[model samples]
Target: MDPYGDTLFNEQAAQVACQEIAALTLRCADDQRKAALLDLAELLEACETTPGSDVLLMGD
Candidate 1:
């Protein structure tokens, strides 16, 4: 696979990881939300490394 393919996989994995982390965070205390948010941030960083012609920073 190419670098772009790898990046896509990484980004999807990061998103799934963040979703799982967020679900777990909801079961924990307020402090746990911070850690979950951190995980989501890391996922965003990974997603940023992916190159594409139609990149989105937000949805309408």
Candidate 2:
């Protein structure tokens, strides 16, 4: 599949992903994973660079 396909890349999807991440982080009781995830989040925030779209995905 073409990752840059129009239907797959949208602001709404990104907002949902961010919301899901916040929800999952709140529900998570695992300290290590939470820390890691938050750390990554912070690192991303600090970096001036960001991928154009769909840089990562959360999953099983």
Off by over 4 Å in 2: 1-10, 39-52, 56-60
The candidate that achieves the highest TM-score relative to the unseen native structure: 2
Q: Candidate 2 on 1-60: residue-level lDDT in tens? A: 545543332344555555666777898899999997776555444332345544343332
C-alpha TM-score for every candidate: 0.40, 0.45
Candidate 1 lDDT by residue in tens digits, 1-60: 353433333555555656766667667767767786776666565674665322233322
Decoy 2 TM-score against native: 0.45
Off by over 4 Å in 1: 1-9, 30-60
Candidates' RMSD to native: 9.8, 6.1
Cα deviation in Å at residue 28, candidate 2?
Answer: 0.8
The positional error of residue 21 in candidate 2, measured at the CA in angstroms, is 0.8
Q: Whole-model lDDT for model 2 versus the true structure?
A: 0.56
